[model samples]
Target: MRLQPRFRRPGGPWQASDAVLAIPLGLIVAILIADILTPPNLPLGPLLIVAPTMTAWFAGPLLTGAVGAIAVAAQVGAGVALGILDMAFLAQVLALVAVAVLVTGLCYLRTRHIQELAQVRTVSEVAQRAVLRPLPHRIGPLQVASAYLAAEENALIGGDLYAAVRTPSGTRLIIGDVMGKGLTAIGDAALLLGAFREAAHRRAELPELMAHLEQSVCVNLAQPAEGGEAGEGFITAAVLDVPDKSPKVQMVTCGHPPPLILHARQVAALPAARPAPPLGLCEMFSPEYFVDTFALQAGDLLLLYTDGVIEARNSHGAFYPLTERVARWPQISPPELVDRLCVDLLEHVGGRLTDDAAVIAIQRTQDAA
Candidate 1:
């Protein structure tokens, strides 16, 4: 959803945040009172420019212009009350007016720039959603929930990506992280997600689906980049196939972190016995990919995440303990589990992450068993 800036509405009434305008207004009043009480030689009239200058910080152009006008009028009143209409007094008034006008114009430019940035952010979000479509809350016998955090400020998606598709007999899921971050890595991420969604339904086996993804990434990396040089990029990923009739999940890892299974208040990582190289470098390793099977009983929750989650560090440089943290809330539903983890992950990193993170939680319902 598009989010409007909270500073001001297009045509609606003023918001409570605007109450901060009183600071500048109060400064103007205080200056006027002090000017009246002090001697003429003190020349306090020059300080009135501060009112409009301060207003520019919290208000838009129109409100800033109003404050400027008030300051100018007060300067003139102060000059008359002091009985000093000398050229110096007049110059001080003109100088105050000039500063106020300059600040007001600057405020207008800043506001316009913010609006343009908001437009760009909205378009970026729409494109990200199209490339990394949200997973369904319920897919056959499995309940699913996913969350993503971008290291780049104001970005909705980055190197991390996840997607799921339902097949004739099961649900296929893929969670991957590109080798880089920000806009530079979005192309590879989009390519991999597109390939996975297409192959997830057609390919009958997990290894075949992964092979297709590897080929796609290889083709993408082979292309010439912006400077007409061959691109060099890779993606770490884990692909899983969970059949509706079986109590096990088939997984193939491509140099990615292992997923965790939470059951009976215990958490265990499901690392592949022999993991394949990352997508673009698969040709460098053995041509065959190994598929690992793990039991995923009813009431069991599977947690898939990028390395950013486990690698997140605190002030003391200690890594986030993903397994221990998840084991504490093993009984929660898929959505609740994901929501709580996202919050906790951000808090652990001091509310800002240094790397892109993506997480997915899938739970098998009792009836499906």
Candidate 2:
């Protein structure tokens, strides 16, 4: 998926915030005038440092240095005007120059740090798109839309993941959340998604596909990670197979939240009759994975999401009402539905989520052949 573009000012180097530079420039002029008007003993040249220091806050090193030079020139002009080019006045000029240089150096460091941060964000976005490949907007008779949010500040992806593959007989979809948060969880999420995309096309049966995923997870967790113990993590996931000509969806819930079916004004949560254990912990329970079949009529929407959606809490500590909220917009398009739910979910949590969230809306657009 393409990452959203960040908002930028239309102009070149100078941004809208650069307009504030006028304040510091005006300060320089005021200080110069004050120094010239004041008595020779009460020089205001030292006050000129304020201009460059203030400029450093909004402008980069080059602009800050230029302002500092102007401040220094104004101090010299003040000295010449008052005919006080003595040791005392020279000391004030040197002090002003020192302060200006200090602030300019700090500005350079700040600008470099921001550039580095932008690079990291760009890399993370690339990784996110590669791992969670975008679901086709139209796959066979299904219309699909998905959204993902990371809990980590400035991160594009985290533990939550989702992907869809178009197979010869059907469309296979998976939405999952790894055990942890932040960058630590990305490795496991990528592993699961990679396994799904590769195995979805090869495995004809939903149970077989789910079994392969569980085995993949088990093998992955059994190996010790860098400085961490082995077999320490697990993932909650829901996998679905929607055949091109079938009027039903085959699903296997592995310790994940149930998918909700929205038809007209009704919202029904499809909980698996015999849900399997989460991928990595399947060995602890019966090895068999059961596939539950649910009717998916034309125009019916399937809502799949990670736990982050329902677990989102407001200021009052109440969880978000996903089913109730979805029932209100049952007839909306898949894209519109996903967009609305994402917006509402963020608002319910006061604009910051405590966990990584992923949501997918799939609508069956035609009847079975």
Candidate 3:
């Protein structure tokens, strides 16, 4: 059965909890009634602390305090009804209030910590947007869809990167992964993306654009660090140029995974015509790069992804069979295809991916001759 896309509404840091607050409050009332009706020796006053503590987990400090106050009032009334206005009953009431105050404060601190995390996630998302702008659903003669899964589950951006933009020559795109994860790789990705975006517009040839990216990385990597080697990192990338007027796609692979072309219910990996080294290490050996041109028919879908997807491992240590899995969704749209792949990938790996994964699906529309 085909899985439908699930839409989730955007929520803020201060979004209300889905739990019913009235249930806890009613339980507090029930506990007070039981204390008043039960035998004097039953001693149900201690149970009143549970009300405020429960509220603390799901509510703000003010609401927790309010619940605590109600609990304290019930305890005092119980003491009065039992005719036990002695110092012992007074001590019990004091202890209940103290517990309430402590629980309320703790809940407040927990809420604040969650809010801080939400704020951090928000900031990361904004930064990711600035670095990796949203890809268009339709670009020239293609229907496009892309997905990125960060290695850090909570992060909005990761080492895996992709971009697609229309140029005078054609619709140019790149998908790549840096050597490492976190901020440093993100920095490299941002550098590569910036270079690609700018150079794709100015350069007419695909190889020249690739050279521009390599030159940018070489310059950045050559900069001396505080205690590390100048050329300590490299990025594995694949660049594709789909001409606006031709039913052909040109590709250049740089120590990156070969792209998969899906057509006629089969997935074929498009190997580069000539091997090329990663972007940053071009200064070391000066490796030669070449573009491989493939026929892209109207119904053909071109998929570019990072190693994270292929290298994803299950409990049995088996890498994900992307080609085999992709065969199951031959008739789906580009967006649906991407969504299905993401869901299946996560399911194959037991719901958590250790590395960052990124994939872009571009289907040549029927408008193409």
Candidate 4:
């Protein structure tokens, strides 16, 4: 169903209420002056329609109706002042009233539709918070920042997800993408985030944490497909562990995108040496996930993201070059870096994305304790 476009109230050096009062007053003054300046044969009564038609855009139904009524009253007074209250002049008055009534009805319907849309958007934002609470700006010694963009417009949550929290061993984080769309994908994302949050504190090693996540997925999703084969539901994930005292970060990839490391005006992809299967299908085809250790010195930045960022296409069907664009800024704060990336990504895809995207940035500060 195609919905009506939302009517935006007046702003930017103009107030809605002020315009409502000022427009009809200006119209009445102009009508009076035109009646006096022109000859009696010239009909200036029809110009009264301008007041209500313009006011309908910025006022509520009742206010619009009042403006329409004022316009009709002004036309009748003009006729009396000109000493011609005959059938032709009376007919003009009736026509002005009819047009005002129609415009008022249209304004009423437009206002009602806008209210309903606002309520729906509020509910969606609340659901997004229930699924994925906002990540903090700081986790332990690292400055953290995150951003998410859903595939559907007016939607707040989707298949892409990320979580970062201070754990017993260190600060552990995971960014994953579930294998579907809409509510089904959101459910899977919520389940994965819940499992990761619980297991991250107990398991210190990256492989062990991924193992726990795999077990959770296997137990939670076992329904058979239409052909009686096991259901194919899986999540591509990347898990990372950052210890407090060491300048090293350990990462494990499960068929997901490798993270990028930025240091000293250089950017490089940290691809997994031996990649394993995604979470849900690992039970059927067991593959050993390996922990790839890389040095993460102070002032270095680590960026974890979903495939949506790299898969966004332009008008020419060209995928976004994330690595090339991100290398330009190696010394900004984590929050500023994420903000810049979000703006640039939107520009690359012409201000819209076909898939859900997410990004998490963590910077190892220079004064780590």
Index of the highest-lDDT prediction: 1
lDDT of 3 by residue, 124-178 (tens): 8999888988799999888999998876856767888889878876799999999
Candidate No. with top TM-score: 2
Ranking according to lDDT, highest score first = 1, 2, 4, 3
Tell me the TM-score of each prediction against the true structure. Answer: 0.90, 0.94, 0.89, 0.85
Scored by lDDT, model 2 comes in at 0.87
Ranking by TM-score: 2, 1, 3, 4
lDDT of 1 at 274: 93
lDDT at 188 for candidate 2? Answer: 89
Each model's number of backbone clashes?
0, 0, 0, 0
Which has the higher lDDT value, candidate number 2 or candidate number 3? Answer: 2
- Model 1 CA deviation exceeding 4 Å by range: 1-6, 9-12, 80-83
Question: Model 2 misses residue 312 by how many Å?
Answer: 1.5
TM-score between candidate 2 and the true structure: 0.94
Alpha carbon lDDT of residue 166, candidate 1?
88
lDDT of 4 at 232: 63
lDDT at position 218, candidate 1: 87
Candidate 4 C-alpha error for residue 102, in Å: 2.7
Per-residue alpha-carbon lDDT of model 4 for 149-263, expressed as tens digits? Answer: 8878678779998998687656888899999888878888898899998888888577788888998888767756457766568999998889887887888899999999998
